[model samples]
Target: MKRIVIIGGGPAGYEAALVAAQLRADVTVIEADGAGGACVLSDCVPSKTFIASSEVVTGYRDTEEFGIHSDGLEAVTVDATAVHERVKRLALAQSADVHSKLVKAGVTFVAGTARLGEDTLGHTHRVVVSPHGSDSEYAIEASIVLIATGATPRVLASAVPDGERVLTWRQVYDLPELPQRLIVIGSGVTGAEFASAYLAMGVPVTLVSSRDRVMPHEDPDAATAIEQVFRARGMTILNNSRAEAVTRVGDGVEVRLSDGRTVTGSHALIAVGSVPNTDGLGLTEYGVTVADSGFVPVDRVSRTNVPGIYAAGDCTGVLPLASVAAMQGRIAMWHALGEAVVPLRLRTVAANVFTDPELATVGVSQNEVDDGRVPARQVMLPLAGNARAKMADLHDGFVKLFCRPASGQIIGGVVVAPRASELIMPITVAVENHMTVSQLAHTITIYPSLSGSIAEAARQLMWHDEE
Candidate 1:
């Protein structure tokens, strides 16, 4: 039986270990922290739970427009403490669920630091083991090893996370009370989502972005819509502003920008980026090549240069998403177990940023086509024109489709609407199956639903204005 060892208990590692165990391989998973990784305990689950609370409050605010509310607006009070309590409870419950699965699958669970041990085949094939508690360090001989150590929030030299005044995304859950003036730095997906959520919760928000607009990696039109909505909600958005330092003042925090401007807030959240947890793994000693950013270099099959050693998830420098990580882990095990498996394909990958009105996309982006990499024509249908969007009181959103100019083959698409993250699945399927724009246009989507706009966008592309 092949002994397969997985490092880190994130979705990637746990999922891979389960697969290896089911294949009858002796699988062992070594994780320093608890199972479920940061995705569940800190990042994805916790944040989404908080957003759910904020979304409920936002619905109440919209009741006046629907003529469904009469009075009691002055008596409404937000109980952030209660919301946070539920978030923590849900996160812990899910982590326990993951722990149960690993045990039932017959995978050995070890809690401690893991590293490379004895190596063979020119330091390619190696032993991976770790020390647990005070007991003597145990060693596990692995015919194959999978590294799925995920990432942590990136820290700036200018502003360190204090878990109080200055906070990281991980520490935001520990806040005792909502900040009267919350300042969020970085305009990426994490930043925008939190800022939007807090604003919906009735907290005054100030978004500090070094770029010209928020969600710079997304479609420009979508970004503009988000910015407009934020401004309309009384959010103070500071663009082209770079934060130089963050210091805690009396009862709050102050942020100083490079332009010699200073802004004070009750709290500051640094949603900059993430750094892969790759240090001290003894990777180089095992002939594993690492990138400049300390990420392990792996092929499409999740194989490292070192034989019998593989890496997946954020550690492999792949797209940083829980869904992608799970897929990568399965692919790695399939290849390592000598089963038929296809290489990883980024072209068919779908990603979503869970901001208000969301932003979801699959396959290629318009920027790629503009750079002449993928030849395609595009068409956009505004949500304002959709009957469902009108019924749902949505005025700002759109569905844009990219297709081959002559053949009308759907290459990629973007959707910006409420729960666009869930709505993008059909577009992902269309891209994966290589469906045409006309095919999407013909697909029956329920009327008076936001998904219908996807079909309408394809219809617009089918009957384009000729030159």
Candidate 2:
């Protein structure tokens, strides 16, 4: 049996372990955190759970518009502590579920920090695991080593998290009470998500954007819509402002901007970005190439320069989505174990920003088209034109499709609506299979549905082709 060792137990690590084990390979997963890593135990699961609570509050507040009147609406309030308690409970349970799967797959689980080392012969790879809260160290020699150590939230020196007033994305769940006025720095996905959730929960939120607009990486149309929604909900957006420092003031925190201005709030969340957890792993010593930012360099097949040492997930500096991480992990295992595998195609990967009226995208983006990287025809159908959206009181987004002008093949698409995450799947499939716009238009879609907008967008593209 081929022995495989996976470092880190996040989506990438755990998924790789299970795949390797099922292939009848001896698999071991060494993780410093608990099983499920930051995605499940800290970042993704916790934040989504918190967002769910905010979503419930938003639904209740919108009930009157739906012709439902209830006396409880006026008195409804979020218990920050209780909400966090549920978040923690759900995260732990999900972690336990991943652990259970790993156990059932006959994969050895070790709670420890892992480092790369050479075997006694100095020819094969070996992992030295230093167990958490203990000094006992053990080494596991393996034919293949997969690095999936994931990443941690990047923090500025001036905005150090105190776990009380100033916070990182991971530290938010531990709060004892909700902030009366919350300031979220950085207008990327993480920053926008928290700002939206808190605003929906009735917390006064100020979003500080270093760029001129929020989510600078997203399509301009989608970003504009989200910004409009945010401002419409009483959110104070500081555009073209950069946060220089965060300091405690009496009962709140003051964020000093680069332009000689300051914004004070009861608490501040630093959602700048993330740093990959690839340091101190002896990667350089093992002849593995690591980028200056501490992310491992890997190819499409998830292989590092050092043969038999593959890296996946956030540590590899690929797209940081959990789904992409899992795919990379599986591809790494399949390649290493001599199984049939396909190299990762990033264009087909779908991503979602979990805010109110989520923004989901797949295939080519509008920026790509504008930059002349992707020559395509584009069409957008407003959700307001959809019967279901009108009935559901949802009218903040659209479905945009990008297709090859000559052949009408669907190349990419974006969905900006409630549950855009789900709506983008069909578009993603169409892009993946190189399906034509006509095919998508012909696909049966329920009338009066958001997906109908997708079909409508495709039909619009078909009309453009005819013209």
Candidate 3:
């Protein structure tokens, strides 16, 4: 029987364990953190759960738009303690769930950090597992070794996370109370999401973005819409400003910008990005090629340059998303087990920023089309015209689709609205399955639905093609 040792228990490691076990391999997963790694235990699950609470607060604040009386009602207030408790509870529950799934799939779980052992270059490799807070270690022999150790929030000496006044994304939950004001120093997905989330929770937020706009990687129009929404909600956004350092003030924090200005807030969140957890992994010692950026260099099949070894997830730096990590892990196992496997295709992968009025996208981007790299026709339908969006008071989003100019094949799409994550799926399906604009346009959609805007966009594209 093939023996597979996976290091890390995030989406990549756990998902791969299930697959390898199903293939009748003896699978062992070594996880230094909880069963679901930082993603479920500290990062993705906890953060999203906290964000969901903030969304509920936002919904209550918007109740007046639906003619619901806010007068003579108990004022809604956030209990940071309660919110953090629930967040941690749900995260632990999910971690337990992940562990149960792996066990049911006949995969062994090792609670420890793992590294490549000597003779790792051989056909069969050795994995050294060192349990936390222990000097004792053990070795597991494996025909295939998969590294998915993931990454950590990047910390700068000038802006260290004190877990109270100054914070990293991970330390936000540790805060005892809501800050009088929050200064988020990074406008990428992490920074923007937190800024939006805190603002929704009735916290004054100042987003310090080094770039010209928030979410520079997202669809430009979507970014503009969200940024506008942020400004409208009284959130201050300082663009083209880099934070040089963050220092403690009197019971608050002060951020020093490179432009010789200072901004003060009760708390500061450093969302500068993440660093891959690649050090001390013994990858280079075993002859596996790792980039200077600390990410493992992998082919589409998730294989490293060295045979009998593979890497996946954030450690590979393909895309910093849980879904992408899971897919990469599954692909690694399939390829390792000698089963028919398709190489990872990132183009069809859907991504979402979990902010209020979430932005989601898939496949070809409008930037590529505008730059003439992709010859595609584009159509956009404003949600304001959609009956459901109007009923729901959603006037700030649109559905945009792109199709091949000649073939009318759906190539890409973007949806910006409440739960855009859910609405982007149909477009993702069309793009992944190579469905045409006509096919998607003709698909019946329920009336008075935000998703109907997607069908409308497709219809407009088809009409243009017909003309």
List TM-scores for all candidates, in order.
Answer: 0.96, 0.98, 0.98
Candidate 2's C-alpha runs over 4 A off are: 71-74, 119-123
Residue range 377-416, candidate 3, lDDT tens digits:
9988888999998888888999999999999999999999
Cα lDDT tens digits for candidate 2, 147-250: 99999999899999999999999998888888999999999999999999999988999999999999999988999999999998899999999999999999
Worst 10 residues of 2 by lDDT: 117-126
Worst 10 residues of 3 by lDDT: 67-76
Quote the lDDT for 332 in model 2: 96
Q: Report lDDT per candidate.
A: 0.87, 0.92, 0.93
User: In model 1, where is the ten-residue run with the lowest total lDDT?
Assistant: 120-129
Q: How many backbone clashes can be found in candidate 2?
A: 0
